[model samples]
Structures are given as C-alpha cells and as structure tokens.
Target: MFKKPTTVNRMSQPEDFKNAFVVGTANVQSDGKLKWKIVAIFPNAGSLRQHGNILVVAGPGGGKGRIITVNLISWGHSAIVIDLKGETYTKTANARYKVDNGKGKVVVLDSKNGTGHRYNPLSVVSRDQWFDLAAELISVTNGDPFWSSVANDLWLAAWSAAQHARRPHMPYAVELMKLDLSDAICYFMYYHKDDPATMQHLLDFLGTRPNEEQMAKIKGGNASRLLESMWKTVKTTMTIFNDTILLNLMSGHDVDVEGMFYNGGITTIYVIVDETKPRVFAAFGRLIMKTLGDALIREGDKQNVVRRPILMLFDEFGRVRLNDVFDWLDTLRSRDIVLCIFLQKLSQFAPKNGKEFDESDENSFHHWILFAPNNPSGRIGKLISGMSGQTTVRADGGVGRSVNMDGDITTSRNVSFARRAVVEQEDYETWGADQAYVTLRQLRTEKYVVTSANTDNLGWALPPEAQPLPRLSSYVSPLMPLPSEIDAATWTAAQQIVEEAGGDDAVSNAMRAALGGLGMAVTV
Candidate 1:
C-alpha cells in the first residue's frame, strides 16, 4: 500500500478536457462519498483533440486493479480485460452482467481455470483468411525463406482439408499436419478432383494425372520437400494445442462477439489466460484482438448502430509482444476500439531483451498514467520531469545602490520571474506510493493525483466470487493426435496387399496402399 504525503499534491491546472476519460477517484473521507479525482491537466492551455487510449505504467500489487479498473467497470465502459488471475472478472462480472437489470452479458474465456464459455477460434475466421491464420500459428524462422513458404503451403493445404473435414480447430489441424504429406495431397487430388469448390491453384501446384493438364508433379518431389518443413509448425502447434483445458475452452462457438457486443447487450469480455506462457497464450490473445475488430467492422457495415465506444483493458500489456502491440496501436482506434494498456515498467515493454521495442513504441498511446515512482536521475524520472513542462514563478526584487561610469550613484530594483517545471524530477524520485503522474499528451501538460491505496472504500460494489455464469456441458475435449490420417478401410486394404507382398515394412506395398493411393493402385 502507498502512503500519501502530508502536503497536498501540486500540479498543472487541467484544461481542454473534452471527452475526458476518467483516470482516478477521490480518496474516501469520513463522509464516504465517492467523487471523481479530476486533477488539473493543462489547466492553462487548450487542445483540439485527445484520444481515448490510455497507457497505465505501474508495478505489481499496486492499485491499478482497485483504482483504475474498478472505477472503469463502475463507470460502465465496454471492455475486453485480459484478467491474468481471473480476479478482475470474479470481482466485476456480476455487476457487469446485471447492468441494465439483467440485459447485460459477460463473456469469460477462462481456459486456465477451465471454467468459462467455449469458443472455436477457427469458426470466426473465413476460408480466405486461412493463409493469414497459418502465418499467426506458425513462427517462421529468419534463416530460410523457401522453407517458410513451403511450411505455409503445407499449412494452407492441411487447414483447408481440416475445414473440409468439419473439424477446423487447431487440434484437428495439428492432427491433419501429422499425416504423410502425399496422403493429404492424394485427398485433394483424387478424393476431391471432381469437386468444384476446392482450391484449383493448389491442385495445379500439386500436379494431376498424365491425361489432364500437366501440373507440377508433387507426388514424390513436392511431398518430400514439404514434409520436413512441417517439423517446426507441428511441434509448435502440438505444444500449444496439447492442453486439454485449452481444447475444452475452444470447443465450440460460444463466444459470439458480434451478437454480444457489436449488436447485442454484452459489453465486457474477460479472457483468463495462462500468464506463465505468454508466447503460447499470445496466440489466443492475438486472436481475440483481431476477431473483435473484425466483428465490429463487419457489423458496422450492415446497421452502423453503435451507441457506446468500445474499450479493451489489457491488464498484462507487457506480457504481449510489442510488435503485436504496435500493429494494434495503429489499427483499432479508427474503429472506436480504445486500448487501456496496463504495464509494470518501461523495460517490460521490450520483453524480448529490447529487440521488439524502440523509442517509437512509447508514442503509440494517447495518454500515459504512471504509478511507479522513479529515481530522480533515472531515465523515467527525467522523462517525467520534462513532461511536467515549465511554469512561470515570480521573484520579488529589492532596491539596491549602483554606480554609473559618470560616478553618479543610483538605486535600481526590478521584479523578475522564470519558468520552472510544474513537477520536478526530484519530486518523482521521492513521491509516495499513492501518487501517480498523469500525462495528457494532447494537452501538453503533466498532472498528478494520489490514488486510493486499497479497494476497501470503492464506490461501486464488487461482484461476489460466488456469481455463476451459464456454461455448456459438451466442449471440445482433448484427444491424442491420431497415429495417421488413413481410415480403417484403407488400412485394411493396405495390410492385405502388403501381407500379400510378404509383409515388407520398408515403404512396403502395405504402407503405400495404406497411404490410400499415392500413385495408381488396384481397386479391391
């Protein structure tokens, strides 16, 4: 808990606060009335525009959850909070769902705890986006371009086939990838050769029979080339989709962002993720970020009836990569999707040893809220000192005796003033825990306020932990990766043929037959 200093906090006056997003609330007094803490921000000047985006810089166990989040929920802003510990959802979901007297909806993607709404990440993705989907799931190395392209091609093929097979989820896609490349090629070439809806370019890429249009011969050469490229993708996907709880969480299409928030009554969506596995969890995190924007845009095209602007409260912002953050910072604002990025420290922005972040990354947000105090000489403190800008301070002058070159004595006095920083660097270094610096970039002035130390005196009621959400019983449970994609009938036929071939296991007649006809074979 942060202790406030005895003296009142002095800051620049707040001005140009049009469309002001609430930052903090007043500390509880003996009267116990919750009042908005509207500290002065650029009270001397005005600005034309101020974006709603906020960047909250704070450390763990601070009052970010209690001061900022609790109030925002109480203020009834639509949010997509990344509740790492499920604490935010547990405390706020009841009030959020019961808003407007039971019309509000709360969507929880609580895979880590294994109790929440289930969703199929693939169902929301259209067929044309399969190539993009492949890009997200697989991390191609910088070492080779040809191999990456090959992997993407293989992924696209398997992705399409999995969707065609009615199980387009990651678990199913991973299962499809584990199969022999030629078997999948065979399914596309022979099994769906006559089907008009399949990808013909892919078909032509992997050649057809001799009498037809001569396409690239993929049976031996292409399949072998593509087979090894899948090692990285298969390993990564397998590791992520291997969790039973994650599979169950993504079992169906229970997360309807379009119906719920875009067109329906649901305003807040809380995704409880495994904070330990940021990279793995980022896949799903990225999915939610992209899907929500897509849903809003898609629905806006039809009716364009939007009453409230949407806010995405990303609690563990530093857990996600800055590369992804930069992309998000560029895209979501225009669609009325504002982001409230809660971070622990400045270094946390560049999680991967500073490779992913640079000086430009800090400018992405419209406003900055600092909860962590810093050393006066440190980079962050210096930056805050600069942000506080300079103010005029008057100095009174007294009469003094002066002698001119002509030997005449005269008395002269003058009053002078100089501009000094509103809040000095040393102040930041020695500030108590309760103090936070609010920088309104548009207003061009730094502000300060003392946040409440705990959640005890919050104006709004916290949703009780016993609040229950409606959950479906049947979810996509985990299953072992299938040994191979060959069916029972094909396996039986292959065994009989190979048994007829004296049981040779080295690419035996049984194996090729079990491959379900890579080349021409006798119809039993």
Candidate 2:
C-alpha cells in the first residue's frame, strides 16, 4: 500500500524552492500539482536568504550539461563556476551577461594559460590572516611533525614579511620563502621593528628566545640536512604557483570578492582549468573559499535578505579541492553561500589520500540528485533503493481449477501483498535517457520520475571581455642593522659594550633599540 502524503509529497514543497535548480518537473500527478524529485533546500521565511549545499551525481549522457551548466543561466545569483575546459563559459557566458537585469559582471580567471582576468588572491589579505594563508599554502602531509612544524614557521615568517612589506603576492612569498634564514630574520625584524608581537614571532621562528639564549640550542640555519629536506618539500608544494603564468596571474588584484556579492548586481566568475595542472586549482579554490566564506558568514549574520546568494557551481568538482571543504560546508549553513558539486559518481568524491570515507561526507549536501545510473545495482542504486519506502503489491494465485456449481469453472486463489522497493535495483540501471532520481535529506523523500531535462532558458552568449594584466609591483623596508649591515668596527664596539654589561644578549637587539631611536631598521 502507498502512503500518499508521506511518500509522495505535495508539489507545493518544490514551489517553495522556486529559485533552486529544477531536478525534474513531472511526477505522478495528484491534487492539481505535479509530484517530482527536485534537489532543493527550503529555509524558513526568516532564513529566506540561505540555501543548503548540493550534490549531483550523473553519469555519461545523463544530461550533466543541461542540468548543471545549461541551467546555470537561471541561477540569478553570484556564482563562481569551475569550468574544466573553456566550454562552460563559452556556452553560458552570453546568458550570464544578461542576468541581473543585464548588469551582471562576468569575469574569467584562467591562470594556467593566462587568459581572461587575473586574480591576486592575497590582494585583500589582512595582517592577522597571514598565518592562516601561510598554513593553507603549505599543507600538512604524512611526514615528520618536526619538519612540518619548521616549514609552517618558515611560511609564517616569509608571509608576514611579504604582507607587511606590501607585496602580498604568491611570487613574492615564493621569493621570500627561498631566502636564507638570516636574510629572512633581518627582513622580518626590520619591517616589524615597531611591532613587538611580530618581532617575537620572528625570534621564535628563528628557534631562539633572547632571555634564555644558549649557544648549543641554536638550530636556525638552512645548512642543516633536516632543514634542507623541509625546504625541498615546501618548494615542491609551492611549485603549484612558482611558474611565470601562474605567478603573473596571482601577482595582483583585479577581482573584488566582497563587492561582487554586495555590488547590487549579480557577478558570475568562471575559473578555467587545464586538466594537467589541477593542483593549481587548489590554490584558487582555497583563496575563494576563505575570502567568500568570510564575507558571506559576516553578511549572513546581519540577516541582509536583500543580498543575493553566492552559488559556487563546481562541475567535475571531485577533481579539485576547496580549502577545509567540510568545515566550509558547516559554516555555510544559513549563510547565502551555496555550492553545487557535480561528479560522474559518488565514488569519485571519496578521498584520494587513503582516508576512509564516512557517511557524514555524503550528509554534507542537503540534496542529492541521481540521473540514469550506469549501474543501478551499485552503491548509488542500493542507496536509492534503501532510501525509498517499500510498497505492498496484491497478487492472486490458485493451486488448481475446479468446476463448482452449474458447470462453471472457478478456482479459489491465495492472495498475498508482498513488500517491494519503490525503485528496484535493476530498474534504474536500465533507465532511459529521460529518467532521473532525486532525494532531499530534510524531507527524507525520494522520487523516480521522467525528468523534463529542461534547458530552454539557455541562450546566446557574448564574447568574454579581455582584461589587461595588472602592473608589476614590489615593496621593501630598509635593511636592518644586522651584523652583516653594520661596519666591522661598530659591530666589534657594540659586542664589547654588550660583554661589559655582564650579560650575553646578542648585540643585534641593542643595535635595533639604538636604531629604533634613530628611526633605522634592526634585526633580531
């Protein structure tokens, strides 16, 4: 027996999510509304601006294009799409140009081949956020904890110096990271001479504390074998962006992240990727995740319903990673930030690093839409089968036929109503091009229906506007009064004065204090 209201929800619910992407339109008609399986989120009226994350699993010829990109035209919000090839933008740019009443700004970032707009991801980074960006750029891997720690310190020192010096570019960070320890120490101490907290951070990074200074405890040099190995690892990881095209694109700011949301017009950004250099995408994805995530969370708290939602549509998303993705998903709740991830199979989304995949990973998305599964008896098929409620079917059977009264032949039948899956395992595996399966986590509902697969809204696109590259830039603080910078005579005199004071503080600090009086730089 079929439970009408519970198993087959009213179409009013899908209408509630009018703005969400349509998974399918028609279902078993009931009560003047079409029953359907639509991957959508319905926040209460009070949280009208929020939309939950989405996961779309569609295999080949499952209409992935019509569902994700072709339908992208109607999204009517701020979107950052990961266009694997140039096709997504090529097909959708014109319609996107006409979005938001024809005022929408469409920007493209193709750092791999250096076409379209350039984005200096660090352009808007504040001094306080340097450490976080540092951590992201150099990821922690399965390695010695001590070396990983040293690499972090090294990144922190270089990033801090670059940020303070006003050259917060990847190329500049790479330049600073490659510096010898003494030069970096001098760079940090001099640039942050007025900021004691940063001075201590630099000193601590140098593996020393002046008050407890000991000669044998010092381990602050690039010459050590262990330290060299750490540098090699850092360089290898950072090699993602150390090249000419990547560096030039990330060298300066052309994109305004916060303004794109609040600018009163929708902004559609396409991040073009070269299939060969996917790790390069990690840098960009993490940058946008942090910047956009911070801005949306801050604005969402204000309950500004007028601000348009920012939807990040990632086609073939499993190929790249967002920085701290699951944590990012948690933060997006009730925030006007939405992400729709598309993959050929759910298995593609599993971690490549040998970490076990958990149910919670799948739970992160509020909606999951499946198209004609190539293997309905596979995990996805079983998942859908399990989610759907079972229904009883009436059957009539008889052991034998017997002639009863008046020479009429009749047989008494044994009737049974056996429970069966709404969508059998092999049913979807043999699905035609028009069929689709949609599930919503909140409603705990599933629908197998003939989808409209509608993409009629997609229209002509205009040529993407070419953006000229940003000008070359750099910054520096005057060299500090390190031993290398000071005259030999003055250094010897300062050392003699320090010895006479009955203490063993490095002469560098005393020189920094003296130079601090004269407004000169000094190193720790």
Candidate 3:
C-alpha cells in the first residue's frame, strides 16, 4: 500500500540542497546551476616509453656523445663499445666502473699504430654463420659478376673443410684464408696471376700437405720466393697485420667466453673502428657483425642463453661496404639482434656512374636515426622520409566570390575570396640506381625528435679541418696480441735459423731451419 507524504516542520530550515553541495569557491544555486572560476587546463604527459634499441644520429660535435652519456647514466643497461675513434670516450672516463655501469669496455682496433688484434669467430658462432659473412663480402665485391660464383664456391669448400675437420663452431673459413691463397697475401711483395689454377694450388697447399711433385712445382714457381719474402713483407706492411689482428679479435677465445660478450650494463654499443683503414675496417666490421648474428642465433637454439639482446651500432656505416648487413638485420630481429646503422648521406649508398649497386633485399633496417640531411629533396632524403612516415603538404587557390554594388551609380563592387586547398602530397619514386624499401609494416612506432638548444654543440662529427676527408676513423682494439709485434718477435727468433743453415746444403738446411724457427718440426 502507498502511504501519503506528511510534511514535518523541523528547525533545520529544509536543509538547503544548494548549501549542501557548495564549497569554499563554488556553489550550486537554487536554480540547480553550478558555477566556478576557471583556473588552468593541463594535458596528460603521455606514457613513459622504452625501446629495445636507440640510434643517435648527429654530425660530428653535435651533442650525440652528451645525449648518449646522459641516457646511459639514466638507464642501467649493458653496452659493448667498438671505440672507432680512440678519442670519443677517453680512457679516463672509461676507467670508471659506474660510467657505463661497468659494461662499457672499449675494443680499440687501431690500424695506424700497428697494434690491432684478432679473435676466433668459431669460438662464438656456428660454421654456417661464418660462411654467410664470407659470402656477403664476396657478393658485395662481385655483385652479379662471375666472380661471385667463384667466391661462393670457395666459401662452400671452406665450409665443407670446417665441418669435416670437426670445427663447425670455429672460424676455420677465415683461418683458411690466412694460409695465403696467392703471393698477393704478402701485398706488394709479389703478384700471382688471377687464375683458377693458381688459386686452387694455394688452397691445396693450405688444406693438405703437398706431395714431392707439388712441392717441386711450388718451389720452382713464385711460391718459394713468396715463402722466403713473407717475413720481410709482413714487417714492412704493419697495416695488413693490424687488419688480421682485428679479424682475430672477433674470433672468440676457446676458454673465456664471457670475456668476449662485452657485457657492460649499458644499452648502447659504439664499435669505434673509426681509426682503421676504410676498406679493411669495413671487411672486418661485416665479418664481426655477421659472426655476432650467427652466434646469437646459435645461442638462442641452446637451452639457456646467457647474453642479452645486443645493438650493433655501425657509425659511418656506408664506408664499410657492408651492404649485405641489411639481410642479416632483416632476419636477426626475431633473435633479438638489433642493428643501429649510421651513414653520412643516403646518396653515398648509390652505385657510381657505370657501376651497379646490389639491390638484393634492400630496405633491411627497421628503424633509421637521421640527422642534418644534406639534400632534403634528394632521392635518398625522400626515400628516408617516406620510410619514416613523414608527410609534406602543398596548398593552392581553390574558390572565389563576387558581389553586386547596392548604392553607388558609377561604382560597381566586386568581392573575391582567396581559397587555399591541398594540391598534392609527394610519395617516394623508385629508380634503377636507388635501393628500394621492400619491408614496410603498419604499426604505430615511436620516434623522438631530438634537437639541441645550443647551435655550437660539439658531437660525433669530425672537427672543421677534417671535414673534407674521404673516410672517418673506426679504429678499435683487437682481442689478440698485435700481429706486427708477433711477426717481429718471430723474425728475431729466426736469426738462429740463418746461423744453423750455414752448412753443406744451405738451401735444405735453411728450409729445415726456417721450419723449426716457425715452431714446426720436420721429419727426415
């Protein structure tokens, strides 16, 4: 049953609903309208975002170093720096344990002073991966030419040897190259004709012990002379030896695998091979990166992976001629191997006039860190902009209006409106010489717009005097002993050979003596 409401009068004065809702500075009146003074409006600051990889791009002395240092201090992640320029991060700063969270160890491979080193790639990577690197080097040099086939066949043969010798995990393919395929291995000391027979003979000598006839053939040819001049030539050309040491450094040691990991707790790794000769450094860089990718893949296959995801930062990447690096990056992301590649200008990547650049699997890098583009409207600039999802708008005249005059007899009024409309948005155009971006994804990616308040900022680029130089330094230290010093030590130890060989048969005695000095014992 519904009960009729009875009004009960109380001293509470009907408890004013407006007063009940009112605060110190705002009120709801009897009309049921709320009023308040407007103070300020603020937007949300957005999410605190983090990326697995961060690529810093700026011209020399543009504050990249400062930014990188700040980020390293803020986030405690491991970094493996390939200190190309010995000057970027000085030893004083690097000596401190907490600078890069103790993960910032510098590998200085300086070719100038002849103190470079090497490592065993097989110790860290699989056989197949090493071969891939070698194959890439060959492909870059040969492209679609017939020499690429030869390089492939040579690589396969070397790979087979590594597998047969139970060195599937060793860098036997690279080591096989050390045995001197031609007298040219000694550089300017001698030149062997670029013939298949000569190449095959060199391979046979390295892979197996040659018989009497084969040795006689080699002895009668330039091989014998090369064998004699090898030590002298190695002494004169310290740069070549330095390059070899760099290769050995990437070859991981058998015992201390952890040491090779460069496990400093920093996210960024600047492999500063900046001081190395451009061609040699590029070759080594390609080899090390390829080996790293292969090693990570192999480790991923294992039950327990010890290392974290790595960022291989290739600064001045175009100089290295590691075009095949794109392919490795394309596939390695799933295994957590990210590549942070830097190039001076995109146009430098195009093949020169009358030369064809390899376009196989172009568009390999997932992210680009571009700074101070030389030609914003150039082909490479447009291409990069398109890949990075940047857009440009153009406006043109759209509509007009006219009006008739109302009062004046001799004057007529006309009204016209200037209308603005979007005319066109340019898309990247493809060219035969230009590399294509085949890998495009539809994902909301994040990119930070980095700008400096100071115009006089000094960063990674070279100083004013060195701007016109063709190549930038990418020097880093090696993992092994300096080959030049080692070779010198070996030669100093060989003085004993000349003394021992001064007998009835000086040639035979010299052969035996030289072999013994080289730490090899010959059986009668």
Candidate 4:
C-alpha cells in the first residue's frame, strides 16, 4: 500500500553541467539509437577540488587502474607513484608523457640499490620534531599506553643524541640497541666541552636515565631497562637497516619535500621497489606518507595562499603493511592531499580480528570506482552491494496442474518476490576489463568504458613505443648530504677502497672497523 518515490533527475542533460571533466564514455541509448556517451568523472572542478580523494579497486591486469591513473596524469595533476613492478608509470622514456602535462616536473627517487635520488626521512622537519619522526619510522602505535611511552622515550633519547652530534638523522638500528649510557654521556661532554651552555643542555636531556634509587622504587630495574626492551621491539618490527642500501639511503636527506609539494610545479616522486624486496617497499611507503604529510602540515602553517592539489597513486596498497595509513586517510583529505589507494578486494582492508576495516574512515572517501571483481559473493561484492543501495523487485511465475475430480480441470498458482540489490554479485563478476562502476554521493551511478583521451577518434591505439616523451619543466638534482669531516680526499680514498673490495658492503665494514680500531685516538 506504499508507493515507491519517483526517480528525479536534476540535470536536463549532461551538457547542462558545464565544465564537467570527462573520465570516460559509457554505452547509452539516445534518440532511439545506441551510442557511446561522454560521462563526467566529476561533476565539475569544484567537486573534484572538494572531494579529490579516490579509492580504486581492481584485480591483476584489470586495465581500469592504468586507464584511471593515466587519465589523471594527462589532466595535468601532480602525482607520486609507488612503482611496484617498475613498469606501470615510469618504465619507458615515453611513459613520462602520461605525467608530463606542462603543469609540473617529474622526479624519480630510485631506492632499488641506491641508483636514484636520495630521501632523508629526517630532513623535512626540524630537530625538535625528530622524536616523533623516529617513533613513526619504528611503526609505534598508541594501543598500549605504557609500551608507547617507553618506546617514545627510547627513540627520543637516541634521536636527540644523533641530532646534537649532527650525525645521520636515521642511524643504524643496531646502534640504537647497543647505545652505551656512559659512552653517550662521554660523547656529549667531549663534543661540547668548550661551550658550557651547550653542555648543560645535553646533560639535562641525558639525565632522564633513572639512577639507582629510582630503579629500586620500581619492579623493573629502571628507565634504561625499559628502553632496552623497547629497542628489542623496534628492532624486530623493522629490518631495512640490515641492508646497507636501505640504511645508506635513509641516513641521508635526498628528496626535497618542499619542492615536491609547494613548488607550484608538477613534482613526481617515483618509488621503485623490487618484488623480492617487499620489506624495502613497506619502509619506503611509510616514509613517503609520513614525509609528505608532515611537510604539507608545516607548509600550511607557513604559507599565505590556499594549498594546491596533489595526487598520489599506490599501485598495490595491500602488499605493504601501512599501519598508519588509516590515520593519513582521515587527516590528509582536509590538507588538499589526494590519495588513490589501489587494492584488489575489500577483504584486504578488513581487520585481522574484526568484521570492519582497520580504520573507521575506510569509507570516508567521497568518490569510489570499482572495476569488475573476480568474486562478487566475496567481501568486495557484499560491500559494493551495500553501497549501491536496494530497489523494489517484482518476480511473477505461473504453475498449472490438472484436477482428478473434474477430468478436464486446470489449476494455476502465482509466486511473487520483491526487494533486490541494484547490482547483484553476478553483475560484478561479469564486468569487462575496461569497464568500471563510478558512484558519487549526490550523483546518479554511472558505468564507464575507460579509454585513452583521443583513442576513439584516432581509430588506432598508440603503443608505448609510439608515445612521445614528456618535456621537463625543470632539472632535479640528486645531491645528498655527506659527513662534514670526511673531506674530499677521504671520500675519494673510500671510493677506491670500495672499488678494490668489489662490493659496497665490504667497504662499509672496513670503514666501521677502521673507526673502531682508532678507539679514543681520533678526533674531528
């Protein structure tokens, strides 16, 4: 006895909404003919600016991921891509055309064996913020108050000492575990011996180590004991430092965060990681998110103009353990930072022991695009079904039977059913590789057949070889900081030693042994 509300369309036609950006075309029937109709990816630039963040889900070789990312790049958007296989975004020289839209410059930060630009995780923030930065690098969470406090203190102490000595921002993890309390005290005293004010500051910072009396008051030995336990925990979670390439790369300030984010040019940071080295990718991924997020926050406080939009594409998001990504998603959207998280299924985002996703804001992104999934009855299917809402359904069936008493008799029965999901599980499983279902908060759902911008009119697809290389707006340098006291002569000698040893690791071990052999004799 209830009437379903009539579906109302606000736009008389697609053209009524001017300035709408086309994401792709959809098969539509207009004027009694079936034809491809241009579909707006976003209603307008304002909508995009307001709700820029997007979540892209597709399976292997789905084609939607490439189509969407390539389109965005061609639109002159700035982006940072985590190149997992090294072929998606920046494999070929011509692939640069996908991102070179005259709006910005692209810089690739290669972490695969230290052949690319260097990125120092600690260089973005001031010395005062080193404590927090160090904790993040170790993947510290606030789940346990006591352990959190212990880890924070341990990281702060080690980071403080390093900053005071002007050492590498992120030192070897082994050094953190092996810090000698007495040696740390002596190092501070000897380094700042001439300056009384500097010595006092160092003393007060190092004074947090609980003395004998304080140790007796607690069941545990003292603060130092707690620090050691926390260091063990930190060491177990992160193993990138064990690899010389990762340790060396993280120790120096390589990528310029300010130039990438606020330079008003198209800046690109390409993170290339080998499949065999997933741990390296996870570390670099976390660093990229932290560095960029912190830099933008600081710039927001300093700059007078509104923040510009920046797009970030994560190729295989679920491959890495991004524990803090939930927090980033909740905060970064407001900072004018857009993140495109690519995953294969909704189950990937689900918590290990909970029904919901790990983050409360997992569904906070205003726009969503789902390509055809392999299994619709699975987690992603159920999620998309729920998101697509429900509609009234009417199914009618008739049955006939013969009545024995009347000789010539007929019986009829009818069955009816209502209530069905607009997009069923089977629908998702049957979608084509190039097809995608796009949904926005206040707009009607659309189905897009993604293709290159002018591929349809050109009547032929342009292969990677045929694509032109993009023009560079500016030159990006890869010069990173080196030990100040290690003069040119010393560095040249070290290089010669490395060449003779036939490997970087051997040379590094030799240098460390050489420094240890000097004992207290060497002084800068």
TM-score of each: 0.66, 0.65, 0.44, 0.59
470 Cα displacement, candidate 1 (Å): 4.8
Q: How many Å off is the CA of 461 in candidate 2?
A: 3.8
Error of 1 at 128 (Å): 3.4
Badly placed stretches (over 4 Å) of model 3 are: 1-69, 72-75, 91-96, 99-118, 137-270, 274-276, 303-307, 348-363, 372-376, 384-524
Model 2: colliding residue pairs = 94-461
lDDT of 4: 0.45
Residue 141, model 1: lDDT of: 47
**Tens digit of lDDT per residue, candidate 1, span 268-348?**
678889877766587777666656655654553455465355667788756655455656554566555667777776666
Q: Candidate 2, 25: how far from true, in Å?
A: 11
lDDT of 2: 0.50
Q: In candidate 1, how many clashes are counted?
A: 4
The better candidate by lDDT, 1 or 2, is 2
What is the clash count for each candidate, in the order shown? 4, 1, 49, 5
* lDDT at position 285, candidate 3: 63
Q: Over the stretch 426-454, how does candidate 2's per-residue lDDT look in tens digits?
A: 33223210222332221123111223444
Q: Is candidate 1 or candidate 3 better by TM-score?
A: 1
lDDT of 3 by residue, 199-288 (tens): 343343222222344345443544344334322322222233235445444443322224333332333333456443676666566655
Per residue, candidate 4 scores C-alpha lDDT tens digits across 475-495 of 222222222244344334434
